[model samples]
Target: MNLSLCMIVKNEAATLHKCLSSVANVVDEMVILDTGSSDRTPEIAKSYGAKVHHFRWNNNFSTARNEALKYVKGNWVLVLDADETLTPEIVPQIYSVIQREEYLLINLLRQEVGAEQSPYSLVSRLFRRHPEIQFSRPYHALIDDSVATILAKEPKWQIGYLQGVAILHKGYQKSAIAQGNKYAKAQAAMEQFLAAHPYDAYVCSKLGALYVTTGKINEGIELLKRGVRTSEENYEILYELHYHLGIAYSRLQNPKQASLHYQAAIKLPIYPILKLGAYNNIGNLLKEAGDLKTARKAYEAALKIDDNFAAGHYNLGMTLKAMGLFTDAIACYQKAIKLNPRYAEAYQNLGVVQLKVGNHQASLIAFKNAIALHQEQNPEEAQRLRQGLQEMGLL
Candidate 1:
C-alpha cells in the first residue's frame, strides 16, 4: 500500500529536515502545507521532493490538516508533525499494517522524548484516505470521530494497534518552547474546546493539565476532578486525572492527599513509567514526613520496575543518608552517578555524605565536580559548594 505522509508546518526549518529524512523513502508521497513560513522551510520541503502548498495562518490546526489531506493521493495517509520521526525499524511494520484492508485506522505508540523516562501513548495517526475522513477541533485536533464514523458505517472496519512501532515526538523539547508560544496557544485552544464541551472528560483533562503547566493549581485541581468524574470507562483518563491530582495536592503541601491519589493511580493498570513516578513521588512524600523506612521501601519498589533509574537511586541515597546508613548511601549515590554522570545534585549530596564521614579529600573532589556542573545551571548551589570548600580550608 502506498502511503502519503501529510504535515502542516510553519517556520519548522530546524526540525523539518530531520522529520522528512526519517520517512522520505518510506512514504510514496509527501504532502506538506506551509502556513506562511518566512524561513527556508518551503525550500527545504521542495528540496526533499515534497508537494509544498502555501496555506494562510488561520489559527486552526484542523483547518490546515484538512487542507493538507486534500493533496494526499495515496490510499493510506500517515499524519506526522515537523518534530516527529518515523524510525527505520517501524517503516516495514507500518507498510504491512496498512496493506491489510481489514483495519480502517491504526494507532501507533507516540513516544514523548526529552524526559528522564519517556512516556508513550497510543495515538491514531494512520488511516485510509476517504473524503469524509476529515480532522476536527481547532487545536489539539483529531480525526477519531471521523474514524469512528467510518467504523459505524462499515461495521467490519477494525482499529489495529501496531506493536513495537513508535513515532518519536520531539515537539516538547525545550528548544521548541523557547522558539514559540505553543503552550499559551494550546491553553487558549483548550478553553475554546471546553466552552462547548463543559463536561468533556478528555478536554477537561487537557485543560487541567495546561493549567497545571501554567501554575494555576486550584483551577487545575477543579478541572481534573471534573475530568475524573466525567471519565466513565477510560482507565487511561482516570489514571492521568488521578496522577495530576496527586501532583497538585503535593504542590499544595497536602502530602497525605497527594499520597492517597498517587496510590489510587498506582492501583490502576497503567504505563510503567507512570507507576514508577508514583512510587518515586510516594517515597519523596514519605521522606518529607520523616518516615525513612517506608520511603526506602517506596524507592525499592521504583527500582524493582527500573533499576537503572538515576533519580530513584539518588533519592534512595538521600533516604539512606537521612537514616545514617553511610555505606548504603554511598553505594546508591555511586550507582546514580554511574547511570547519569551529569547528575549534579547526586554529586553534591555524595560530597555532603563524604564530608559527614570525614573523607575530606573525596568530599573536596566531589564538591568541585558538582560545582563545575552546577555553575551555570544552578549558581546558588555552586556558591554553597564553594563556601563548603572554604570552610573545610580546601579552597
Candidate 2:
C-alpha cells in the first residue's frame, strides 16, 4: 500500500526538514498545506520534494487538516506535525500494519521529548484514505469522531494501535511553547470549540487540562468533573481527565484528593507507558506523606514501564536517601544524571548523597556541576549552593 505523509503547517521551516526526512523512506509522497506562513516554510517543504499547497488561516486545525487530506494520492495517510518525526524503529511495523486489510485506522504511540510529566501520548495519525474519514475540533484536531461513525456503519473496518513508541514529538518542549504564544493560541482555538461543544468529553479533557495548567483551577475542575460524568467509556479520555485533575488538586495543596485522582488514573485500562505520569505523581504524594516504602514501590513500577525515565530514577533516589540506603540512592541518582546530564536537581542530590558516603571529591564536583546548571535556570538556588560550598570550605 502506498503511504502519503499529510501535514498542515505554518512558519515551521525550523523543524520541517527533520520531519520530512524521517519519513522519506516510508512514504511515497509528501503533501503539506501551509496556513498563512510568514516564514520560508513552503520553500523548505518544496526542498523535500513535497507538494506544498497554501490555505488561509481560519484558526481551526480540523479545517486545515481536512484541506491537507484532500491532496493525498495514496492508499494510506500518515499525519504528522512539523515538530514530530516518525521513529525509524517503528517504520517496519507501520508498513506491516498498513498492508493489513482489516484496519481502517492505526493509532501510534508518540514520545513527548523533554516532557517530564506525561512522556507518552497516543495519536490516531495513520488511516486509510477514505472520503468519509475527516477531522473535527478546532484544536487538537483528529479523525477519531469520524472514525467512530464510520466503524459503526461499516463493521468490517477495524481500528488498532501500535503498542510501542512510533513518533518522537518535540512540540511540547519549553522552547517551542515560548515561541508562538502557544498557550494563548491553544486556549483561543480550544475555547472556540468549547463554545459549541460545551459538554464534549474530548474538549473537556483538553481545555480543562489547559485551564488547570494555566491558573484557572476552579474552571478546569468544573469542566473535568463534567467530562468524567459524560465520557463514553473512553479510557484514554478518562485517563487524561483524572491525570489533569490530579495535577490541579496537587496545586491546590490537597494531597489526599490528588492521590485519589492519580490512583484513579493509574487504575484505568490504558497502556503502561501512558500511566508513567500518574505513577510518578502518586509516588510524589506518597513520599510527601511519609510513606517512603509505598512511594519507592510506585517509582519502581514507573521505572519498570520505562527504565529511562529520568524523573523516576531521581525520585527513587530521593526515596532511597530518605530510607538511609546511601549506596542504592547514589546509583539511582547517577543513572538519572546519565540519562539527563543537565538535571540540576539530580546533581544536587547526588552531591548531598556523596557527602553522606564520605566521597568528598565527588561531592564537590557534583555540587559545582549542579551550581553551574542552575546559574541560568535558577540564580537564587545557585547563590544558595555557592554559600553552602563556601561554608563547607570547598569553594
Q: List the global CA lDDT of all models.
A: 0.85, 0.94
Candidate with best lDDT: 2
lDDT for each residue of candidate 2 in 1-395, tens digit (9 for 90 to 100)? 99999999999988998999999888999999999999999998998889999999888899999999999999999999999999898988998999899999999999999885898999999999999999999889999999999999999999899868899999888888889788899999988888988899999999999899899999999999999999979999999999999999999999999989999999999888999999999999999999999999999999999998999999999999999999999999999999999999999999999999999999999999999999977999999999988998988
**Which pairs clash inside model 2?**
none
Residue-level lDDT for 59 in candidate 2: 88
lDDT tens digits, residue span 1-395, model 1? 78999999999999999999998899999999999999999999999999999899889899999999999999999999998999788877887888797888887877666543324556789998887899988877888868868878889888887765469887776667656888889988889878988998878877897787779999999999999999987776787788788888988999989999889888987546547767888899999999999999999998987787788999999999999999899899989999878889899889989988999888878888899989967888899879877886888
| Per-prediction CA RMSD (Å) | 3.1, 1.1
Q: List runs of model 2 lying over 4 Å from the truth.
A: none
